[model samples]
Target: MSDTTRDGLADRFEENRPRLRALAYRTLGSAAEADDAVQETWLRLDRAGAGEVDNLPAWLTTVCGRICLDMLRSRTTRREQPLSEINDPPSAVESVLADEVEAALLIVLGTLAPAERLAFVLHDLFAVSFDEIAVVVGRTPQASRQLASRARRRVRAAAPAATEPRGRAVVDAFLSASRGGDLGALLELLDPDVVLRATGEAARLDAQGERRGAEVVARYFAGKAQAAVPALVDGAWGFAVFIGGELRVAVAMEIKNGQILGLTAASSPAALAGLTVTPL
Candidate 1:
């Protein structure tokens, strides 16, 4: 690639990185894998002589989607392990999306063929046209639409029953239980296999590599819940704890199956600054 082309690609990456990341995350269901897919997309673009391309953004997105599809295909071979084993444990962002796109949704997406997943994400999630999806999936426009339709039908059939209202109630209950320090109430709402992840400074302090199971989380909370008061983080149900009015920890919960399956607590003051906390 020429210097001019390289400069142009760099500019395009700066402009489109967030959108590309969003697409990959929605398609892959793992933030770490999404980052990998985006990186791979840039590598492919560099190899393809992207400086010569007129539509750098579109080209990058197509390359990113294709890379994500390839990664998803390889992921199918190892489906038995929990998602956290294959990728990083769920983060605050995943917890935010869990209410609308839970584990069931990810499983359903995994069931789809690569082309089908690409078609569906591009068309339904990104609002791309069939023509554009056809280019990305390497199918005719009609075939792309058919692929998306098939994927949509499968998702609908396998999806957990619409749980928007129920999910909201669950979050409310979790907050209530946490504030009251009711371990029994919290465990009652949590799955037996619940997974808890504490990132940034919290992970360093605990040195427990992100707790899992109802019992493990209960014990961890027994210690920290006293120190951390409840508050909302990032417009979702969350808790913010302060030490002498200085942010000390931020907790975010992901509830599924009437239980808490994922909880992420950030303790690094640097990381905490980027997060917005609201009164619970």
Candidate 2:
């Protein structure tokens, strides 16, 4: 391509960067990863040479979509630990969008299988045709549509209520026991097979990736939540820990039969923002 041609293509690519990054973020749920995906798309476009492309926007969109789909697949195969912060600083657009992409929504996305996430993100968020998505996911067009449909249903079902005081009471009780160093009380609040999973900063603090059994779990939190307070985690009972009035940690619980079945701590900015806490 001539200098003019290359310059024109570059301009077009730059014009589409924000949209591409947004699409990738929605699919991968990591701003840094989305930036990487968009960069890779640029590389591919350069190597292919833009002369043959009839619709630059559509072509770029498809390429970015396929790249994200592969990344999602690799993430599944490796069971990669979820990170709280993006590698890159948020641009103005990203910061604005991040606020809109509630922590609850990301939590729900975590539950989806990779293909379902890609299908849902591409078709529903970006308006990519199912036929194009089929190529990325190795599914037929009809199958791709079905995949998105299932994801949509799951997202809808996962929406949080404004309040569930029962959950709040449980979280408060757990926090009180933790602050009081009441191991027996902690054990009483947990199920026999309770599980504790920590991600982002919380995972590093806990040392191990997960802890099991009521005794082990109780010992870990026996006196840890001195600064923790009740909060709504995606509309469920949870707690938040703050330092100097800045939110630092969010704890989300899974309670069943009035006992703690599972709990998660997220120290990432995204997770912290999703938490709804009362004044200290």
Candidate 3:
């Protein structure tokens, strides 16, 4: 294509960039990943000229969806790192809503399988037709509807519930305090009657016992859980400790009203397999 034609195509793509980024953000929870997906979409459009497509907006949306679907699928095959582990700051391209509804929606969406997430986000949130969604998920229209239906049920069942902002914030703070050996910070995050229980490998390692009282629990976790990462354990916010890329221990906590009330550490293979632990 000539310079004028190429420049015109670029202008059209730029016009749809904001919406494209939004589609990607809802499909994949991370702002950084969404920006990457949008950039990939632009690259594809640049290489495959827009002459063959009539509806540029719809075409760009589809391309971005497919890219996000691929990324979601790849998460299962990799030892994924949370967005917090990245060295760079969060992307500015994402929309930030400082409401409980937006935060809860993203948390609930994180629990869904990749296909189910893509199906539901595209059809329900963006009003994309099932036919168009099917093209992205590689399923028939009927199957895509089923995926969305299943996702919808899960979302509804979970709508009235969510991992609260305080839950994640406390876990992050506790982890930071523990890693830094800051006993004072740890005590501040724990309740006066805080308790810690252990099982499996942790038990065999003598890290087991019911320790009560904030000072006791705080001292135990001080400078501990060094290899832990923020994760969702058994539907709540927690941490998974890894040693050389292998999950060695998983800690599930019960936080009530901004305090860390209780924690259970498990390390057996069977126990770990049963827990649905994902990045927070």
Best by lDDT: 3
Per-residue lDDT tens digits for candidate 3, residues 160-232, read 3254557878889999999999999999999999888877665433444578889988988888878888876
TM-score of 1: 0.49
On residues 1-280, what C-alpha lDDT tens digit does candidate 2 reach at each position? 8888888888989999878887787777777788899999999987777877888888888889889888887774422223345444465234533333444446456667788988888887778899888887889999999999988765654445222324545777899999998999999999999998887777554467788999999988987888887765554557787799898887778876678889888888876665554321
Per-candidate local distance difference test: 0.68, 0.75, 0.78
Give one digit per residue, the lDDT tens place, for model 1 in 74-117.
78453322244434344423443445555445546765677887
Better candidate number, 2 or 3, judged by TM-score: 3
Q: Report residue 180 deviation for candidate 3 (angstroms).
A: 2.4
| Candidate 3 lDDT (Cα, 0 to 1) | 0.78
| Candidate 1 deviant stretches above 4 angstroms | 1-5, 76-104, 158-280
Ranking by lDDT: 3, 2, 1
Off by over 4 Å in 3: 1-22, 28-101, 104-120, 123-131, 137-163, 204-209
Candidate 3's TM-score reads 0.60
Q: After superposition, how far is residue 76 of candidate 2 from its true place, in Å?
A: 6.3
